[model samples]
Target: MPPAYPRSPRRNGVHYANAAMTVLLGLGSNLGDRCDNMEKAIEALAGLPGTSLLRWSTVYESNALLAPDSPPMWDKPFLNAAVELSTSLKPLDLLAATQAIEKRLGRVEGERWAPRTIDVDLLAYDDETITTPELVVPHVGVRERAFVLAPLAEIVPSRRLPGTSETVLQLKRRIDDSLPAWMGVVNVTPDSFSDGGRWLKDDKPTTAQLELLDGNYIDIGGESTRPGAVDVDSETEWRRVAPVLEYLDQHFSGRLLRPKISIDTRSPTTAARAIEAGVSIVNDVSGFANRAMIEILAGSRCDLVLMHNLSVPADPSNVLPHDCDPLAVLRSWFGEHLEILERAGIARERVIIDPGIGFGKSAIQSLEIIDRARELMEFDCRVLFGHSRKSYLESMTKVPPSERDPETVAVSANLARRGVEILRVHALDLHRRFWRVYQRTA
Candidate 1:
């Protein structure tokens, strides 16, 4: 269990007694001025009778759901949040107060899961369950709701819900990982495992990247993180990658539709700078191990890609003796590291998990990771599959990495079938075709 957060300063009108119980509330908005509505709701909750806001979580954006009674359709993205309150009010009173705050914030009558200016649902109260016609203690579907559990974990990962053994962190990781995102590969290194020096011009990268692929997004990496590749200093890596990001940021402005940009780096300095340059993600292969890296990422607004890696090259001679379950080890590693992130206030939704296809794993282990990618959803963050043109595919196909596009595409489709969220690849044309055909079938 994680340590409890210390009591915070009290609000002007609310007095929190030492005996006050801590409660967690889920707040969200999908309609007009979402962030503003959430702020208003937080202010309202802070002054509720016998309640003081102890802490609030960083907001997370997630796909909204359509009304169950209405035809299935994708709604606007919801800005979701979690608030911890130190309160002495009865559960019913707290619930009524939150509902009143919603109405006051201009939440009008609407169908279930419909867009709202503000919505507050009582998540958990004092580890006690009140089963009644009007209320459910643990929140009817909180245990399985990733959007709710993720923000809740951000503020209080160790908190245990009433009548359940899982803590907020555990529940967050165990929640079903939904939402699919694609990532095109934009290799900028001179020695990338495949496609080395092809995109190696000092010119702007917006054109190079846009010309390379068109899909959900593109991952821009400066250094070659292939097997046995050497580490580059942060300055050198930034020099190679910053220009691309700056150009992309400028080029995408005023465009109605632009792909998301992800920066792949292991250096904390590079990650921080790339985020400052407007990259939406930092794909770190070190599983966010370094404290500086974690701190920098926590302070930035970008989503994180924490990949399981050995932090060094994989020498075939150093193979495990026997009976080592790589997947199990990776899972435990993620569980521990993710706790550290949550304890430090990193929102769980702002992360994606990568099994590290070839960072330090053997061909067999890499194959196992692909076959079992869905199992990684146990970590809750979106699972990213980066098996494009890797050595593992070459081993299976007996072709050089550059000629492994077919193998890569086949494996990607399989991973997609297994519910993987992000697919990093070089064959954008084939994937575009696949998406078109697959969407119709899906």
Candidate 2:
């Protein structure tokens, strides 16, 4: 039988100052007023001392486990959900709090898996493995049960269990291998928004740095396309990015496991040179509006990131009309360009569509792009979102460009759930840790 412990009353007007750890909890109810019981239990859990409820998954209905000759009332289906929280409480205290929640909500000491008003199980607590007579977490049955995994995967799809190697999404086994690729950003220019001029002078990017960033594609940009920026000539852009390309070609030319190199440029001349430098992808911030650029890409075997933008140096005022839908605008623009690319003999598969967040849209419009990013899947091409550390993050808060990575990560996780294929980000280490590292153990 599971441990039964009642929670003690909390001391009023006290704040927990300990370092908080993340916790995952599984909740289920099959008894009277199942929905009400689950809601009350969740509320109680949220109200626990030093525990801040993060997010919960959608409630899933599944059949209950019952013993032979069990009463008919004990055979009802269950409503299940998974919750994530940050807490300063120790593992046993957290477990006791959950058990108290179950008891207070009318659960009775009875057979295991028997129908109850509520069942709260500590699925995991910050990568800590604990096995005792009273409790075993990550909940012994979490991996094999759909009721637990289905709800948990909705929130922490890439989270790995404490004693397991496979992530929640991988154990669920629904997604293919193609999804969730990371695109590391390497800004070579002096005026770029996020890490402008950091790589200039003595801090130039090297093969070791790119390898450390660990992106499937290393996106090296020579120009700053931030709002209200000046445009450099094609030769100047090529000169700025040439050394990085040369270093990559010199070291990674014959390596079997090197990241693919992408050149971010709008100038046809720079694109030609980058192609000659053996780059595999061209990220055109100007959305290939130049006919000469289209002609150049049409003749190359490189993949193209055909992005949407109103102007090169992003005019803050050049936004879609107030009444126009942003997705519709993207569709019209992509539809026209896709046909153009096809006519130019560049296959659609070689094209990766980017909505170019914050490029020409207003803050609200940029948000709408993220909120409805999944709709871009209709284009039949991989979607790459470059929303890292942009001004749009400042719309809700007053964070500077350098301090926006946390917000960037929040949006990146949302994009991952929304099915965006690739995330072009400045903070690669943060993204990788959040996505792959279990419980921030890295």
Candidate 3:
């Protein structure tokens, strides 16, 4: 089980003063032009009286519902989506409206999970928990269905279930691994190799960049760990990172969109401060070698990323020995460190191991690790590959950092196929969409 964080008052979709409630609706169609059906459904939803469509999720293709006793022809794939709306209409009334839309869209009275032209379910109405013969607020199917959870998680990840402690994103993480967790990168420095100084203005994280890269798990780094990058003291590092943390805390904490935070720092002091600031993950590029850092991690519930780096700031000249097998070296390093972490009382499940793509590897070594990533999964812990626009790609194509997303996507596709759990990348949207399509198509 993941460690628990303190909860704030649950956010409601309903605006009591105006008697309007925020509502979540699930949309699906396995019949007709599915995409067209979804768009028409959205139009009908927005056209409903006293209701304005707020936002909708991407149309995800999922296998149609089926059972042993069901007809074989019902196996058509579904284009599914979730939508948010605000309305003064009561729950039953809104449900009735959705049903009307389904009826008009060619849905006929049918058996449970039967193929249909469209299906619109009343997922949640604000924080209202309602159960009746006709409806249940936070539809019971929401918890277990990936088809529903994927789209809902896209738009409203931080919103808690009407009566449960779990948020949409939390539930998705618990049950679904069809997609990898996307960790957006925020490098708060002027000297990082890629996209450095783009997100920073006056030595602080700009709101524009933070908003642009908003995601469930965001990795914030003060000191760049890129090869030959200059180092800063703990205070200086924290100074660069604290603003992003503060910005997130002030603007997002305890809200419907609060993101789980990660601090990418090697300094134990910086990691400790980040934990105090409510970060859930400490991505120590130095692999928690410091007894002080291990001690700090031992006492906290924050997840640890034990990355294998040859040296901090990445000594390019210090590449792995040519004769030694890179995977063997990684296995040895991970075994030793994981044992150290286990001795210190951190759970194996809470640790994510990174082979440190370009940190200390030659281009061939990096390619070897990428191709053989599945071998690293032997340790019974999640594996992370931070191969976002690094120099290793230059061995294939000599593009600058800004033009490396396609290469990043290609590598990410390979990692995803190998069952890597998390991908730390510069291009979050591109990778996310690519993977979504990949999963749907495959």
Displacement of residue 265 (Cα, Å) in model 3 is: 0.5
Q: Can you write out model 3's per-residue Cα lDDT over 1-442, one digit (the tens) per residue?
A: 1122332211233221223789998988999888778878777776677776665654555677688788888878887878888888988889888999999999999888689999988889999999899888889878888778767765666678877897675666566444456688889888788888977777766657554344447888999877778889999899888887888777753342234678999899998889888788899998987889999988897778899989998888999998789999999999999999999898776788899998889988999999999899777666788999988889788889878999999999888766676788988888767865786577
- Please identify which of the two predictions, 1 or 3, would achieve the higher TM-score against the true structure: 3
lDDT of 3 at 318: 93
Model 1, 1-442: lDDT tens digits are 0001223354333344443888888988988888778877887777766666676665555667655565454357787778888888888888888889999999898667667898899988887889998889889889888678766765565678888887766665554543234577877777788877766764323345456334556788888876667777898888878777767667654331245678888788898777666666788877876789888977765678888777544344444333688788879978887888888788776777788877667788888878888678776566788889887775668888888888887887788667676788888777756654564455
Off by over 4 Å in 2: 1-178, 202-213, 438-442
Question: Relative to the unseen true structure, what is the C-alpha lDDT of residue 126 in candidate 1, on a scale of 0 to 100?
Answer: 86
- Of candidates 3 and 2, the better by TM-score: 3
Give all TM-scores, in the order shown.
Answer: 0.60, 0.59, 0.66
RMSD of 3: 9.8
Model 2 lDDT per residue over 1-442, tens place: 0000111232222222224899999888888887678777776776777776565654555567667777876667777777887888898888888888888999999887577888888999999888999889888977777667766654576689998887775554434211256788888878787777776665444344554334567798888888767888887777778888787666653232245678899899998888877777889998888899999988886778999988879888888897889999999999998999999998876788999898888888899999999778676677789999887888776878988888998898888766576789888878776764321221
Candidate 3: stretches off by over 4 Å = 1-4, 7-111, 114-177, 211-214, 256-258
